[model samples]
Target chain A: MTDAHEIRHEIRIATGDDIVRIRRAVRTVACAARMSLVDRTKLVTAASELARNVIGHGGGGTVRIERLISPSGVSGVRMVFEDAGPGIPDVRLALTDGWSTGQGLGLGLPGARRLVDEFDLQTVVGEGTRVTVTKWTR
Target chain B: MDRVPILKAGDVLLVSIQTDLEDRTVMALREDLAERIVRTGARGVVIDITAVEIVDSFIGQMLAGIAAMSQLLDARTVVVGMRPAVAITLVELGLSLGGVQTALDLETGLRLLGAGPLDGGPSEAQDRR
Candidate 1:
């Protein structure tokens, strides 16, 4: 009998050229946990978007990937994308489609949020932004 | 970023959206697709979003604009691989491109474009119009 706690793994990496590595790392973990194709796609896409945000929007940041075992006999993957970039002034407006910075398409944060089962975003005006996405498969 | 010419297959055109598909690219695609739609008289257009990580309001609006433009050319447009998170954020921010056609994958997008399927589809030469 394997302890549920023993199944968890954590990865932390810089948000530079390592963005792809972060994505691959998260994908490997999700695959090992037997996440469904659709679920896996969702997770990967979310990770890619978040990773890009840290690189493009924020100067750079840290990404943490972890596998969570819930109490309800359900398992899920949780990724936290934290950046110390100039924080979003309006979280609500930032999530709107078409409302992008004059730079890229502006779909990064909002799109990343929609790809996961549970999405949480917390940003401080002058500080930075933290986005968390979770995908669960029972 | 280097601009890649979109490919046309029979009556369908395949356009891949990567990066932050914004202004210049969106407009260029719109004009190019419109011209192709007019010249080939194709019935469908497939805009692949598999590589697109962001779809800001402008891009979303531009997508809708392109779809509208395609409609004028008598070709239907389908957007594929819209990440769920992006969809939710768009909805939350009220920047919804609700009227446009969307599919889960490229195969489905191709089907919507009137192609048989990505795999084993009839060998129809892809023409860039």
Candidate 2:
């Protein structure tokens, strides 16, 4: 029931150094949301993975982080990563553990999903991909 | 390029990663650690990650690679001081770190490496001081 005037942070993810910045930004917003340390770590880790994917697979993108207030007055942190690189042809396979297109461990997507309470993925073949995740504070 | 310091402690090398690691920096660490092992003839390495708040798949893979490389050079690698949250995220991410050994703290990690079968005889860890 809170207002939509929550603070939003936008970060450009183009290089490996940006990954660190993404994690730090997520940590700051998570802290502002009054999340526990453990929750904050989870969110930041997820953010790191998503940001890396944007750079490695999506050829670079932007990450948007914001403080969210649910209708029940519950507060949380949300992050959205968007990229215009070659989109995923099969999100299901991409999410499967141990399935990687790159030289990664293939845990990025699913692992990020497990760390957050809300997960949504949008992709268009030959266009781009967008991943959104949210972690609610208990 | 920012480099992580590697300290020599007798038969062991202690590497504490305190900064937010860049990919190139990690790549540099791999090469530097390998050269250091060859130069020092150290039998064990303890990597302290207590100050690191988040570990992505890339960093996780780097740790695993370092352990494997050290083993090839006849050195045992032990990772220690993983925060509880990092541990949880690593598991959820499906990375067990496979071959690398882990301990709760640097002290325990040194002891584990010293007592390892490859180490042989009593620990010379205190001799470095």
Index of the highest-lDDT prediction: 2
lDDT of 1 by residue, A19-138 (tens): 556656776778766797656756765676677677677667877777777787677788888888898898899888657774656777776776778999899877898888888874
Taking the tens digit of each residue's C-alpha lDDT, what string does model 2 give over B24-82?
88889889999999999999999999998888888999999999999999999999999
Q: How well does candidate 1 score on lDDT at residue A114?
A: 67
**What is the fnat of model 2 with respect to the true interface contacts?**
0.83
lDDT of 1 by residue, B25-67 (tens): 6677788888888888888988888776545455677789888
CA lDDT, candidate 2, residue B61: 93
Q: Name every residue pair that clashes in candidate 2.
A: none
Candidate 2 deviant stretches above 4 angstroms: A1-4, B115-129
Residue B70 CA displacement from its true place in model 1, Å: 17
RMSD of 1: 7.7
- Which residue window of length 10 is worst by lDDT in model 2 chain B? B115-124
